[model samples]
Target chain A: MTDFAIDLKDVDKLYGGVFSRRVHALRGVDMRVGRGEIFGLLGPNGAGKSTLVKILMTVIRATRAMGTVLGRPVGNKPTLARVGYLPEHHRFPDYLTGRQVIEFYGAMSGVSRHERRKRAAELLDFVGMGKWADTRVRGYSKGMRQRVGIAQTLVNSPDLVIWDEPTDGVDPVGRRDIRQMTVELKRKGTTVMLNSHLLSELEMVCDRVAILVQGKVSSQGTIDELTVHRQRYEIEVSAGDSHVDAGVRKALAGWLPDGALEGRLEGGQTLKANFDSPHLPALITVSTADAQPVQPIIDALRNARLTVRAVKPIRPSLEDLFMEAVTDPVTGRTLAPGAKEGA
Target chain B: MVLRQTLAILGDAYRELNAKKMFWITLALSAFVVLAIACVGINSKGISVLWWTFPVDVFNTAIVSPALFYKLIFIGFGFKFWLTWAATILALISTASLIPDFVAGGSIDLMLSKPIARLRLFLTKYATGLLFVGLQVMVFSVASFLVIGIRGGVWDWKIFVAVPLVLLFFSYLYCVCVLIGIVTRSTIAALLLTVLFWFVLFLLHSGEQSLNLFKLNAEEQTATLEARAEPLSDQIAKSKAVIAQLSEAPTDETAEARGRREGELATKNASLTGLELRQQSTAKDLESYRASLGRLKLWHDVLFSVKTALPKTSETMELLQRVLTSSDETSKLEDAEQQRREERGTRRRDADAAKRDADNEADRGGPGFSPSVVRRQEEINRSRSVWWILGTSVAFEALVLAVACTIFVRRDF
Candidate 1:
């Protein structure tokens, strides 16, 4: 009955027995997801992300747990009626069509037939899967299956919808649609807790994010609060016109070197992974949270006689924050080398 | 509401059964088997209701009455091995996946995470598996019920008991399968283990039964020996006591008393000698039985206990024969046929088999004949009440299911 939809503390899960090699999946982790907020769990592979969710759903038994889900103790069957979960590696029974699968899961949640039928139609449309409703899930592509998975998650109109890697194998467009769906869910005051390796997608939709590293939540807060510690201001000084001389471009290049631009030295934490470096765009987005003021960079650009295109304050992206949280400073070893390598 | 969810699971599972064409194929095959059985029927006039033979035997035609035909088909075929092994095995293979499929990776989590309790989910799924066999047997049982009425003009409702009876017997193996499937979550392993367990149990039961017959024979032999030896033992003891008393009555007595005492001693000694001879013969006769009695008792206790602890599968199947027919009518028909054969003066070699057929029918829920005559057919038979057979077997199945459910609940998906 608390304001939080999920309040879990000191949940520990161990995978094996004594006298055997045991895997510590979750280590006395304490977590809470606020009602109506989009909470993203950011973690590497084997970082205990799915384990934590599975524990809450009672799919995997925790060695120890002190928690309540939807205001009831974890593993409470009735409370699960109000909680929905879409597993990370979920697979629908192939014999059933998408609509039947949706309805079957809906019925399992005790949704009435009339309501299930109506919500199925609405949810399929909501997930942009209206056309594939009657098609057997065996015929579905990965993205289409994800769409159906999302649609089924809404069958009971759960108050707390938890999805693990909801857009893992989805196409870019499907990922955007999923993000919009979460936004809609939040707008309607539904608590959404999702775990995804797609930090950019999570950043676009997550109001708050928890970065888990090696069976522990290393950092968690609103995206802005966590990223504000390392903000970057970029002075995109391009030759405003292509006709600008090569001398001007060369002088501009000196002001904006193709190296780590020093923002303020607040703890001097270096990023272990690049952010938004897809295809290495011409636009150099620099973060100023670590080093000097933004005004100097701009003044330097003006002094170089370069036409300043635009100067924008750049906050650290979730990927940067994730890498910083999970990466070792000295060795620069990612918490999950395997997880990163999987991609 | 929980019940509703259980129903939903049952419904969904049944629909999943439809997802595989093999189930329908199995159902069709079962129906065809029943239809084939239905084709070979007998009428009240003792003629084949389906068709007559091409070259009808003009002379010495056998009389096959409706009652006889119905017994031959219903109890003889339906209750014996047709529905027991053939139909039950088919039903088993079709329903083997019911459990494994329910606990299949992604499916189990969604179902278990629902508002329903895990025990309920497990029980409902278990019931759904039973429904697979129940429906199959029901179809066949009802068809047989119809054939009994249509061909023999008797709507014996007892014939329909095979529906639940078949399910009860099938459950003996399915429970084992479910227990394994819950732990291993592999259909082939579960099924093979169940079948292997059954074969092992069957062999154990048969072995015990043979031992029981031997023990019973030893018991009967001991009783016969003891009966004969009892009279001789009394006579010999009395004669020895009389002779001792007469000798001790000695020198204080008068001449007449001594003479009478001598006469009595002579009579007692003579009788004693006769009794001793008979006693020795009886004791010699009893020795083999006494020796075997000890060994037989030990084996009987071991076999009997082992047999009782396991589910009573043979007795459970026997329920079909018990409920579906009567022994009195069979024995009466047996007598009438014997009388008719005697009047005709033709002693066929099949007479012994016909006598055995009647005895076999009489063996279930009815007192069997003397042990000596039925040795080849002793067969570790029991006249258990329907309740005892069904109740004990169901109890075993429930116990197995309980253990399996506990494991399933505790284990992580």
Candidate 2:
């Protein structure tokens, strides 16, 4: 079995005074991401996403935590050497130009001077920021800075890339480019751990995702697995004039005892049905005044006389699945306090 | 790995220093000092009156004159300009920003994450500070020498040796200031402490001198006692010779006889034993006061010198001990011994003074002396005690520095 690219077992983080005050940023957070997978950590603000990242990076110590990354203990230097991190709101030294910042970070990762220069050039190009490499970071716009931030993260060519709100403040175009680059990195066998509030962007790219709520893993799995509760199936049919109005309805009514049907009549004769079911496979008996072959039932639907007018399924999106996971079962409020609707 | 880390830290230090405007200010100040020294050397009137009084030997005039002058001036300047109130202020200002900047800039996180050891980073930064101070001293020394050479025509190569010694002293002082800056993390507090220390030292010196006045009074009493112990035989002979000459040459017989009798009476009074003389001397209230004053003064001088020397000696010994002891050694044997010696010396001096005071009381006819003289004696004693306390405190500061450095090296930072 492939080793976990990132793993945290029973991690806890406590802040503030020993008594009278405390903020449990993380309470027994358990997470695992497989190698060569783009894993999205989706959460609203203050959902412990940043805390988990900091613990993994060793910037903040975790209480009662044990974990490993790439077979080494989490936060180990060797493991860090193979990991690239872009913080949520990091500010590079203003005095240093984009090229200089990249070179410096590359050097810190133990890259040779010549290789640092080479990699810096290549990474800047990869992030579509080659032209502005000589400009000081102080002068860069938010989008430009985000681009440079990405460029710096790739300088080490790390085995694992962790980006915290990487596309924050980025324009839509820049955000799309970043998403594309992330996918490209994953294609190149680099594992990406993305922490973001952008659920739609994550939905477009992440192979698997975990929703963190109130410092714990609320739900985690592939998109398809999480939404298995909502099942769907599509059916096609053809019919004659008499069968269209009465027979189709009768058949659908018999087939779906506790289901909803939605479709349009293609012609005077053809009909299509869309159904939602708690379970599948029901008996259907149809009687028509005019008889029609099974081929005509299918053909009429394809042509104007029997057109294929509708196809609908009961599949739930990643958003619906996420909401289901984060919604507290007791109060029916979001597990993340102050989480807004549709967020 | 260590070398690379050290170089990186040094580079950071150098870069930071270069970026600071105070570095330029310090450079400008050093240049000004050198120019001032040069201008003074160029103008003959600028030479101190004291320097001109030193007798110039014909054989050594060319070398010794300039060398001696430079040595004196360098030593003076070492304690004056190089160790100025401004230098400490600058040191405090510069070093104070070192750690705070790292923390504020978030550079500490980046640097600490490296494989480099934290203590080594600290040491490298400290060494950079030393180097900066050394450069300032060297610049001032060389420029001053060049000016002096051109104007006074007294260029002695030996004078250059003062450069490193002065630099060493400044470096040590700056190191101490840096340590203070690290501990207190306040530039103003560190500078205030440095200034306060120097002011206290000045106070101690003045206090010590005032205490020495009692010793001078004692010397005066001894001289007076010797003068009062003249022989009666010589006085009687002189008196008889003067009376016979008056009888023979022209004076009235009645007047001459009266003069002779008076002289004879004075001679009889002068022919007293040492014990009787002391008794007679103490009978006079002034004489008794002088005797006690003398005893107080003698004890005061001895105790004062011991008090001043003991701390300095102990300080020097402690500095030596610090140099000799490895950081790993748990026992500070030499430092403990030095402390013991200093305490013992102080106690012994006090005991000796007490013993001498007791003896003086026995020798004096009685304790009936003027209040003013006694007050003066007490004042002298008080000043001496103050001096000793001040000296010990100064030496204690050096010991504090040693301890601070030791603790600093072990701190994780």
DockQ of each: 0.53, 0.10
Q: Look at candidate 2 and give me any clashing residue pairs.
A: A238-A297, A300-A306, A301-A306, B218-B294
Residue B165, candidate 1: alpha-carbon lDDT:
74
- Fnat, model by model in order, equals 0.68, 0.01
Per-residue accuracy of model 2 over B1-413 as CA lDDT, tens digit each: 35544554555466557766877788788776666554432122224332343232221233224434443444355325453446545655665555444433234444433334445555666677665655666666677567557655666454455444444444444545555666776666655665565455445555555445544455455555545545333454564565455435334457777677667555544543433555455446446657677676676666566546423322222232222223333123324434444565567567796665544443332253323344465444433443354346456545655665565544322
lDDT of 1 by residue, A1-343 (tens): 6988888888888876666657777877788899999999988878888888888888888888997888898878788888888987787888888888888889888899899999989988888889989999999999998889888888999999999889988888888789889999999999999899888888889988888877778888898889786776554445444433342334434442444332222334322112233222124344545345455445655675656676666787888898788779889986554222110
lDDT of 1 by residue, B174-226 (tens): 89999998888888898889889888778877777666666666677778779
- Candidate 1 is graded, for docking, as medium
| Candidate 2 Cα outliers beyond 4 Å, as residue runs | A17-20, A230-309, A313-322, A336-343, B42-64, B68-84, B105-413
Among all windows of 10 consecutive residues in model 2 chain A, the one with the lowest summed lDDT is A280-289
Tell me the chain A TM-score of model 2: 0.78
Where is model 1 chain A poorest over a 10-residue stretch in terms of lDDT? A272-281
Q: What TM-score, to 2 decimals, does candidate 2 have?
A: 0.60
Candidates in order: C-alpha RMSD to true structure = 8.2, 14.1
Each prediction's whole-model lDDT (CA): 0.74, 0.60
